[model samples]
Target: MALPVLVLAVRWVMMIMGSDPRAVGLSAEPIDYTINYLGLWAIRFLILSLAITPLRTWARWSWLAPLRRPLGLWAFACALLHLSVYFLLDQLGSFSLLWESVAKHPFILLGMAAFTLLLPLALTSTRGAIRRIGARRWQALHRLVYLAAIFTAIHFILRVKGFQPEPWIYAGVAAVLLLVRALPTAWVRRA
Candidate 1:
C-alpha cells in the first residue's frame, strides 16, 4: 500500500518537474506515462487481489484473506486515478471530447466498461455492505472481477498502436489468474 502510494507520489512529482534529465522519457509525455503507470498498477493490484484466494487455498495461509479487500480497493483507486488523468489531462474535462474518444476508440470503451464493473465491487467491499448483501450474494457479485479483468486486459492490448510485449504479458497474467479461479477446488488441490 505504502509502496504504491509512494511510487504514485514520486511519479506525480516527476511529472511536475518535467525536463529533469533523469526523467527523460517520462517527462516527454508525462500525462501519457502517468496514465499508463496508473493503469498498470491497477491491473497488477487486481491480479494480486485475485491471487489471494488461491494463495490461501494452496499455502493454507488464512492471513492472506484479509489482504484481499485492501488490494481490491487499491486497484479501484489506481483505476480511478487512471480515469482522472484521462479525463482531466487528456480530455481537458470536455464531455464532447470524452464521448468522441469513447466512440472512436474501442479501447476506451472497454476501459470504461471495466471501470463500470469495478464500481460495484469497490462499493461492496466493506464488511457492512457484505453483511447486508449476504455472503453468497456478495461472492457472486464479486465474480464480476473476472469480467473486469478480461475487459481491462483487452483495453490495454487494444490501446497500443504496435505490437508490444508488455500489454500481452499483462493479458497473459490475467488469463492465468482467471484460469486458476475457474479450476475446480479438487483439481487445484491435486496439483
Candidate 2:
C-alpha cells in the first residue's frame, strides 16, 4: 500500500539528487541498496501472506483470510521491482552481462526460480480465475507459494556475503511459517 509507494518515492528522490553526499553512507551504489530493500520486502510480504491462514485458523481471525491475496500480490510486485532493478540498473540492459551474472551466480538462478513460481500464482489470483480453474485445482496450484518462499529465502541467504544475521533471520521465519502450514488440521484445531 502506502509502504511501497513511499519506498518508490524515496528512490525517485534519490535518483534526482544524483550523488548527494548524504546518501554516501547508505551504500556505495544506491540502486543495489534499493534492489535489496525491495527483495527483502517481497520476502516479508510473502511470509506475511502465508501466516494469514495459520493466524485465521488458530486465532479464529477470519478477516485475515481476505488480506492474504493483497499481501501476496504486493510481494509479487516488489519481487518484480527487484528483478527490474537488477536487469535494468545493475546490468544496464546488456544481455551478455545479464547472462554472465546469472551463469556465475547461483543465487540469481534461485531468485529467478522463485519469481517464476510466483508468476502463475499472481496470474490466477483473481476470483474469475479461481472460477475458471476450479477452486480445488487453483488451491493446489497456489500451494507452489511454499516452494517459492523456500527458494526466495535460499536466494537471500546465498546473495549476501560474509556472515550476516538478516538472511538467516528471514530463513528462520520462513521455516516457522512453513511448519505452521505443514501441521495437521486436527492438530491445529486442538491448539
Candidate 3:
C-alpha cells in the first residue's frame, strides 16, 4: 500500500535535487518535511487501528475486525522508518548524539520511548506468541496500545509546539477512540 507513496517521495526528492528541469524548489532537499510526513502517516495509522474495535462494535462491521492487527503492524513499520531516519540520518547513529538528543529534545525523547514500547508489541503480535501466552494474557499485554497512544500523542504535541491544530486534532481523535472502549466498561461497573 505504501509502495506508491515511496515512489512518489523518491520522485519528489529527485525533483527537489534539481536533476529535473521542470521540478520546483529544485535546490534544497526538505528532509524534515519527509520525516514529518512519515511520522504523521504512522500516527494516522495508529489512530485507525485504535478505531477498529469501536467501529466493529458500534457499526457491526465484523469485516473491520481483522484489520486492527495489520494496521498496528504497519504503524510499527512506519515508526521504525521514522526513527531510523531521525537516528541514523539525522543523528548519524552516534550514541553520544542520540543521548544528547534525548537530553535536549523532549519530543524526540518521548518519541523514542513510544517506539521502544511498540517494539515488543510488534514482535509478539504473531499467532504463535499469542497462543503460547494464552489469548486472555495476550489481550492484557496488548492493552499497552493505550499507553503507546498516549506517548505518541505526547510526542506529536511536543513536536508541534504551541497548540498546533493538527496535533490537537489527532489527540482528540485518539482520546475519543480510547474512551469508546473505556466508557462502556466503567459505566457497566458503576451501574
The models' CA-based lDDT, in order, is 0.87, 0.87, 0.81
Candidate 3 lDDT over 104-166, as tens digits, reads 988888888888888989999999999999999989988888888988998998886575798
lDDT of 2: 0.87
Reference-based lDDT, residue 166, model 1:
90
Candidate 1: tens digits of C-alpha lDDT, residues 120-139: 99999888998999999999
Error of 3 at 20 (Å): 5.9
Candidate 2, 24-60: lDDT as tens digits = 4336666777788789899999999998998888888
Error of 1 at 37 (Å): 0.7
User: Candidate 2: worst 10 consecutive residues by lDDT?
Assistant: 19-28
Judging by TM-score, tell me the better candidate of 2 and 3. 2
- The full ranking of all candidates by TM-score, starting with the best, is 2, 1, 3
* Maximum-lDDT candidate: 2
The CA lDDT at 121 in model 3 is 91
